[model samples]
Target: MFARDTDDFSPSERERIVKTAVSPRPVAWVGTRDAAGTDNLAPFSSYTYVGADEPSVLFTASRRDGDLKDTPRNAIDTEVFSVSVATADVLETVDHTAADPGPEEGDEFDLAGVERAECDRIDAPYVADAPIAMECTLHDRQEIHGRTMLIGDVVRFHVADEATRDGQVDSREITTIGRLGGPYYTHTDPVEFERRY
Candidate 1:
């Protein structure tokens, strides 16, 4: 087995090790609207639900050269954002949204040629083709270890008909994508087992 001290690694090496060791992380294809009402979309893998009863989710955005990324900046400004599932059906377009397009270029939605839909309970946009999306308003934001951790209360959910049955989501019907470290992604083929007490 290989053993190494965390303090021995460079920043990039530490990031790579963490990302690789985390295995498959769910991709949060986040959406927000800037002060000028321009829609911004980006993908963040460091995301997870903070609570389920009251339903809140959190995603972390690492600063770029000591500046907040567009998604987090807009989210903080507007106090609203949306999170769309990154399904395999739209993986290519989802990846395109992560590109840092120049100001001359259009927004992520236009750059990726993805159709956008207005989030029902928030003033944000979401990927229309995604299997599921959550409309949320910012609950809190804090800087943690040079990253912005934004928490949002999920106020509404938009689920595709095929992904739901009798008011519940059918995970089997949703072919969601996940992030696997750098430049890699994965599609699910679930292997199930009965839970035993």
Candidate 2:
């Protein structure tokens, strides 16, 4: 079934279509700091890997509200941030960070009880429990459909020893989690399938 561009869909219907269309988005447990050095952590499902080699990058799609979300705002202000991979173990804390708290609501890191570690190359902090964390500096920001698309150049990578093998990340060992439509999530594991080629 197809609807005309002019046709108006209810908010729920529109959300359903968009969420279903964007299947299996990776979660970015972003860490940032306000002017006062108040740590703000938030989990955004609208994130993706952008590049592979030197100047590797990750992009996050941040919706524009009247007030900018702490992650994008802080990243833009300080020009630095950290992106952490979410796992099933940290799902609860990650979800807590997604709450739309007021800017004056103090540090979410302390509120959620999530451990934080200083980023090696940036002033921002990274989630200590995450198996993987990437320190990044803001590369660019573009406005797309009123949403801010933040591109960050990765400067350093922090990988837990248990999650790495021979200089490579073992997905099964990392056990990262991804977001699904309507309060659903999935974890990584070993699964093999033959290529269609």
Candidate 3:
């Protein structure tokens, strides 16, 4: 095996290396509304749930061409956002929203032509067809290494009937998509195993 120090690579190369090594990452389809009430939708794979019980998640938004992206800017200004699970069925739509459309170009929801619904608890929108969507209130925002990391406390969850069983969500029932290195994506097809203590 051959490896070089992180400093050996340029920023873009370093990002590619890290993304390649991370295997499959869950995509967070985040939604927010600008102060002008323009809805913004974007996908961020640099996301994960950081808390339980009260339930919270965090996603890092990076500058596009050295400029702050609209999602984080809206979340920061409005203090609210929504997250919709990116499923395999909507992979193309999810990827479409990744493009940076200027606020003047038009909101991504209309650009991508994906159906959206209003979040009950927040002044934001979510993918109407997604298996799971959560409304969250901004809990904190921090700038690190030129990236904006925003944490949100989940206020409400909208789980599709088909995605839930008994009283909880069954991952097996949802065919979610995962982001791979470069331009690759994977779908969840569970390989069950019994764990023995």
User: What tens-digit string does per-residue lDDT give for candidate 3 at 9-73?
Assistant: 99889888889888688999999998888998999998899898989999998888898888998
* Candidate 2, pairs of clashing residues: none
TM agreement with the true structure for every prediction: 0.95, 0.88, 0.93
Tens digits of per-residue lDDT, candidate 1, 1-197, equal 87899999998889888998896989999999998988899998999999999999999999999999999999999999999999888888887889988878989998989899998778899989888899999999999999999999999999899898787898888988888877788988878978898
Q: Could you tell which candidate, 1 or 2, scores higher by lDDT?
A: 1
Best by lDDT: 3
Single out the weakest 10-residue window by summed lDDT for candidate 3: 98-107
Better of 2 and 3 by TM-score: 3
List the candidate 1 regions with Cα displacement exceeding 4 Å. none
**lDDT values, one for every candidate:** 0.91, 0.82, 0.92
RMSD of 1: 1.3
Off by over 4 Å in 2: 1-8, 61-65, 100-105, 194-197
Top of the candidates by TM-score:
1
Backbone clashes in each candidate structure, one number apiece? Answer: 0, 0, 0
TM-score of candidate 1 relative to the true fold:
0.95
Ranking by lDDT: 3, 1, 2
